[model samples]
Target: MRLRRTVLPSPDLLDIALAFGSFGLFTLPVLIRGSGHSPTAAIVVLGLAATVPLSVRRRAPVPVLATVSLVLVGAALADVGFTVFHSNAGPALGIAVLTVADRLPRAVSLRASVAAVGLVTVAEVTAMQVHPATGQNAIQLVLAVPAWLVGYAFHTRRQAERRLRSETQERAREAERRVRAEERVRVSADVHDIVSHTLSMIAVRSGVARMVLEQRPEEALAALSAIETASRGALDELRAVLQSLRDAPGDPLRTAGALAAGPAVERPTLAHLRSLVGNLRDDGYPITLALSEKAGAPPPVEESAYRVVQEALTNVVRHAGRVATSVEVAGDPEGLSISVLNAAPAGGSPGAGPGSGHGLTGMRDRVALYEGTVAAGPCPDGGYAVRVHFPARPVNRTAPADRAEGKRRG
Candidate 1:
């Protein structure tokens, strides 16, 4: 029982209807007044020629205007009851002028408008000479001015909208590029941390095993076992990082055709510090750890804190070589704080290992993401120390639930 709404016709169909309607209105009155005597077939044909071309006014505005104008002029000269200012000819020419203004360049449209006004004036004057009643046609000449102005306004608005859409698309593309660049930097830093720490441990343990192999078989075997564990852990962490890159939400094809292997491995946090410290201790580093129970933090803050400690310890083993090290982690209402200090080596100066100089920079960058501060320097007692603090903030635990609700609504 429901009724469907009617859809309107397209522009081309509307133009055809206008052409036929105008021709019928123009010829109807003459036939009525003739009372049994209709106009010649030639006059009806001329009227059809003048109005039918208007159907293509938008496609070829200049040509359609010219054709309509010429037909009106011929009809006026032959005194066949058609003039430039008649209802049919006048409106048809006005439509053509509007179309020309909207579709052509301003300079070309302007010239065409001038030529149209001149031609219509000449045709009207010619008709007036033959029929004095046609003198009132001069008043209808002003209609073209408003039509041209309206069309020009439409053209200007269309250009502005096009430019706005172009600028919007450019800005969106720029933002996407920026996000991709930042992700690259973050992933690079993580890989550096993982590879550097694992390789450093393996190099040290492999050297120990090589030196003690003939003299002490058990100790050498232990060192080799440590190397195997470190390598496996490094591989797992690297796989996790690659999986994250593949599963990133921005562009599905960003890591296209790359294999995403292995189960998801949780990112390291304060809870994983004991295992990290134990691994370093087995490698013969003299280290002490002090940790205080703290309230939960956002995932990003926890990850960054763990990296800060790991990088500090790695630097200790690489630069200070088996030195006495102490790590402290504390949290309060204000923020979380971490400090790592290592005493001066037995030798006057610590021996340098393969260092890329990017560890400390990466540490600082991670802390800065959470608006934290980092300070690293040599103490007065000839010990190196790194200190970091991250401010506390409430975590939005309901974010996942909110996202789920939004998806359901959609």
Candidate 2:
């Protein structure tokens, strides 16, 4: 096993050198006899045993270990050179070490390592005992055991490094994915806030325009200018919002909601729903409003309800063209449902169906912010239907104050 483990091309060639080295040692007797002794046969057997076990060491470690050990015993018994058969030894033990460090039980690896050390001690001691007259010291002979132990330590360290690097890379990839996911979330939030807020202001301004168109034509014109300013504000904000989305996700801390809009004004309510409908109806498309709740407790809920209707009607006028737009709003202490259904556009887009589809999606996001749900699809009868629902809050009406502060910016 050790022999195969270390059988790299550069060092394996040394086995041939080992064999040749053995041959030269064996032929020394022949050179001295000068036509007498021939140790060629013994050298050939030692060379064969030394290299044979290397072929299958990795596939069958135990078998390779047994084979090399048997050959070592044979060479030792034959009173031949030990290192000649030692070429296969290192790889067999190295493979044994790998096996012990891997598949075989821990106790088994320990036992095998201990047994290997003991066997090496026995082999070296016997070599000295059998040839004491040669005067080789035991210390020099026993060095192979230390060499095997050192190789084992190196393989262990290399395996540990590979595992550590693999785990660290996996963690980094996971962190990057999490960061990307968070960035997407932050960008979506910003977009929803900016789009919904700006669109609501546009609807409010449009109403203000209709109110003044007849009574104060000059104020109507001023409202139109404000509408243009608000639209431009929305456009510019949307650009920055989209850019934020394209950036990498938050690293240390998640990004917060849209930066405060400075001192805020009272958001709109059901009272404003009329002017909203009046403006569109005055434009060309007729409009109607019906509601179930007469109480005024849920301000955000009312705003969300009004917004849903406003978005639906806007889509109807945009898509159904001149088709009459109608809104039905129902709310109780428990929940509220708002629906706007309009006929198919004569030829115009519903802010969808062609130019872009982000409008409906943005509306849905707004409704969801109120913990509400919205569904928009082609109504079975003919035309598009938008339905939204918001969980109720205690009815709260600040219409008196809201009106005083109601945006004249139309």
Candidate 3:
């Protein structure tokens, strides 16, 4: 059998107990010595007046002090002043003063303290017919000031702690907002990259199938089949990304909600380049890919590399006019580098495509997060090129476990 520890009463309760006990001790002695333990109505009333006000000292400190001080004065006028304050009423007043100093602003508490002290002093001096200096008066006056000072110290410390807590909460909220914003931007970019690339290929292939429908039925059938494949692939990737957002809106972990409720959907990586390039080749684009012999890379670098190549090829299909294109990927531990170079535009026209400018912006934005760089321009040999170099792992920012999670929440 285990015994439970005794719970102590709070300080406020103890304060009330002490206040009433002192009143009884002072009154009991006088009643025993002078009245055979039977007090007159005046003595009883005086004792009640000093003690009762203390019960509410904390909540109504100023009012309690005023009531107790006035009653003490009334007792003196009635010629029972000597015994009235002997009830330890002074301590109750002291406690009230401390509470006032602790709870109110410094300017307000100072004024209130002065008023309470002045009233108590006037009453004591009036009852005793004594000078301001000496005896119990000096002791009472000195003690009250220190109690106020202690209370002031407690008040200052409490204020500082409150401010610190508020600032910490604000900073946490700001960080959460920043994370959410990044997540929204990343999700938007994924939608753009996926839909734009897949749809562009489908559109181009469908047009080829339409042009060859009568004269080359077999070739047209193959183009239509490729369109079906691209459309289905786009739908699968989009559904997985959207499902994650619907699953857990407040998950803080990088992959908290993404793929939690979805069927296993593999994210695109460097290995997927073969399939991507093959599909474009089927669409009649002259494209070549040269990947480094290096086996693996950080997920962020791999994913970014795949998207860059995909977007570059899509641009060629729309604008390059049958120009030869080549993709080169190579890296060491330091960084992974990629470049897509297309032969000069035919007939003095750049590859014009139905595309939102956000593609290049999104590519640059994603690379910058890993402290990587991207440059796209016309080469000295009159060819167009898109080059990107990503750090092997994120620098200046913590690396996330699943880089594909960025497709949903960043």
Candidate 4:
């Protein structure tokens, strides 16, 4: 807490101000310097020591208070040669009370402060009456209440301000975290799509080149050239996206992959499952995809809905134990549905890839945010199943349904 308060702001100046105020705190003694009974050098020294604590008031309020309050009690009781604790224990009590309130918890800090004031008040009340039974003095008794109250108010305001500032910083940090996460999602999905698609194209080209290697050298070279171009383009786009998210000490907004060119979309939607499944089947997974709707014309409601399936399938292909897989996308008017089932990879981690574990949670957040429902769990048939249902109303919709339907039909 001391470092938090002292490091960011100008602590030296604050400390100096506090120390100067400490000197002023003993004004009563200076005023009574030569009046009748003299306050000796010892009392003056103790008064100065009390002021020394004010230097570190913000740095270590509790320790400062502990030392000052103890010294204050002694200075108050002992005659100290001739001077009587500068005839003012009121200021010390008040400052210590404020320090405790600032540094300690409400209950503990309050009890200590109340005890200080009560003791001072009782001492003053007794002092006022000669041979007093209560052992109090009048002057300090009258002063303690108002001082403690004012100190408490000041401490409360400062603490409140500190809390508000901390909250604002936390919110900003959370916003930064979300921005970074979104960037990762955009980039990861893009990379997954591009790499997977390119891999397919390259594999086909390579197979063709292998056949034509001896018969048609030029054709093989042409396919190789296309591969190079595609690879370079993918790399360029990936680099741009990464640069945008980097904090490189210069232009804060790295315009690597911005939406001006439209969102960095690479991931396949439900419509692309035919090709995706074909690739997997060719690769020996022997996968089949069955859809609830034969037409397969997914609405905006099934946009993120589609990504969830892609992710689940990707997981199955990479981690599911069995080679053969079944992907099903089906639903009624209420919502769309999707599920991917494959045997768990033998001893394969439940999630074998780079999902932040928050992916499912994030998918959950997306579903809830869009007023949709989704469920993912290990299926009873010894595999994993993920189902997503996006309501027909749509997460982002404004047009009248009748007009939209007429346009669609037209």
Candidate 5:
């Protein structure tokens, strides 16, 4: 990605200012002192050389250091001291050394610093005839060494900050990948539950309509109508799933609560349990339902209960033929429990046809969403049973006591 440069002060402008400021700080003293401290032509030239090269310090720090160091030595050789130039090169050389250390590798910056100190010490010794370990050499070492050290500190800080930013970005990307994978699993499970049950009923009803079409027109018509109703309902549920997919990110209407909002379809709850049982009875499945009088559960838990029962009954219809099956549901504020029992198939095979497929997997997935558990196995007396239990609260729904009191008042 191309990053656009923001509007800020230019580096070149700042460098130019530093260059001129150093020139004036050094030369102004000579001008202020008049002819009494008049600077020679060589002195003026050497001072200009020391200050002008600072303008390009950021781009070529090492080269600027070399140039300025050369000028310092030349001034020392040509009798340039406190009166003529007044050590203007000290601060200017410090700035250049700092720039080099901050931008370049540690080894390279260290070598440049050593070279600068060596050159300045040699010039001071030759000019003033000072000893090798004198105060002048000590002063030069003190000034140059600290500047490089401070610049290296800044370089280390910048590197640490950049590494931290990169790591944070990588972690965020990994988290997003995990979320998308989970969303895919969730969408697949929902689609499986919605499509599998609806299509199974339609297939059974279609077969019934075909068999009865030649013998009883009325019965055949009823079966065909049932297929039509089932198909339309399936289409509606499928549309709701599709709508949820559209409400994902990158959509203009994708607000904060859009994901939890889901589709506007009426989710099936325990109140529809009776109608579900009635419909299964109409299809000639020998299933009995026993629900508690004061069963209360949250909407999500209720929806999960309804689906668990639906999947259980569908399994009975497919694998057990017309065997006797029983469904029991009981709940209070603390939790809800469900159990479905069925006599094994006449052939004695427990998980025949759709019984051992994704149907059970889908059921377990749904129940687990509510932190529920399911156990399905053959009973000792020759039957199969599925049981589920999940925690719930009765605070949001009507209890049996309240209903009975209302009935008495009425």
Candidate 6:
């Protein structure tokens, strides 16, 4: 069987310092006492082998521990002046065993610890037989247990810290994904509202212009002018929506700032309802509008109310045809209520054909944001009606300059 060679990392500065320091400490006593019976060179060489290998103990802990143990055993068997319990050998062996417990798997490190302890004990016993003075080495055997315990404790703490860090990063990623998804839904709703309203007006005006082209040139010209105006308005709104998308911040957490980065688009409010009604009137839509505007409604609430009315009117033009429509906007201290009702077509059912239903869905989504409610269905008189109510709330208006500065800081 082929055996895998374990890759070891190059020793760093700390490892180099540790190796040299251990070497000096281990050999200092020998230098002072002098080699008793063995040659001075052999004892120094044996001390070097036992301690210097500690430098790479973290990278190849098992091998380093085994090497230090075997060298200590050889010295004791050869009857050198020192035995396995020499000042240098005991410390070097403890450091190697500590590293094995810290860096290797528990099962492998446990086996390594047992083998090291056995090897050193047998060597010390053999050396004591040759020279009785070496029997004190047996006391150092107990040091291995505490070294392994300390290293294992460090390993457990490090693993726990790594797991906590991983979970925190995953949660941050999930939150970003959710924010981006909400932004997409909001953008899509804006696009649908703009396109649906504009196209409905343009389709009606173009047909009128085509029908009266030669017989009544003035009426045709007026219809064409209305179409041009609606198209331009649609283009401006679409450009603003596109700019918002382009300017969105890369980080989902900063979505509000990203939206604010786009060029400020003037959103429709209750004041625009008069102009909206006038445009439909010009297109020969038999419509009557009544407005009772109050000032304290928030900007978001105003915009949502405008969208609900716009979508309702567009549905009237598309599905109800040229029918009498009444739009009423009433406001009190409590809240605002809007109602748009269109009578049934001259000879057909109201909303008879297949419909996408996106308009109503978008309306519900917008109203839900402000804790409002929307009701729409066919009435008893074969007419269609949409009614919406938004509860009154205090407006918190921040200056444009402050918003812009916030965006810059974000």
* TM-score of every model versus the real structure: 0.76, 0.42, 0.77, 0.46, 0.70, 0.71
Residue pairs in candidate 6 whose N, alpha carbon or C atoms collide under 3 angstroms: none
lDDT of 3 by residue, 280-368 (tens): 77677788989888835766567767887887777776667678999888878877889999997777654454456678888887677
Q: Which consecutive 10 residues in model 6 have the weakest lDDT in total?
A: 395-404
Q: Compare candidates 2 and 5 on TM-score and give the better one.
A: 5
Residue 361, candidate 3: Cα error in Å is 1.4
Model 6 quality (TM-score): 0.71
Between candidates 2 and 6, the TM-score winner = 6
Residue 256 miss distance in model 4 (angstroms): 17
What TM-score does structure 1 among the candidates reach? 0.76
Report lDDT (Cα) of residue 193, candidate 2. Answer: 48
Best model number under lDDT? 6
lDDT tens digits by residue: candidate 5, 32-80 = 5662332556546766788889999989999999998887776565555
What is residue 249's positional error in candidate 6, in angstroms?
7.3
lDDT of each: 0.74, 0.55, 0.71, 0.58, 0.71, 0.76
Give model 3 RMSD, 1 decimal. 5.3
> How well does model 2 score by local distance difference test?
0.55
RMSD (Cα, Å) of candidate 5?
9.2
Stretches of candidate 5 off by over 4 Å are 1-12, 22-56, 79-89, 130-138, 247-281, 286-313, 322-343, 346-356, 360-410
Candidate 6 lDDT over residue span 102-179, tens digit each: 887788898998898788778877777877764335544777888888888777787788899999999988866654
Candidate 3 regions exceeding 4 Å error are 1-54, 71-90, 130-135, 247-264, 293-301, 353-356, 392-410
Number of clashes in every candidate structure? 0, 22, 1, 20, 0, 0
Residue 312 alpha-carbon offset, candidate 5, angstroms: 4.5
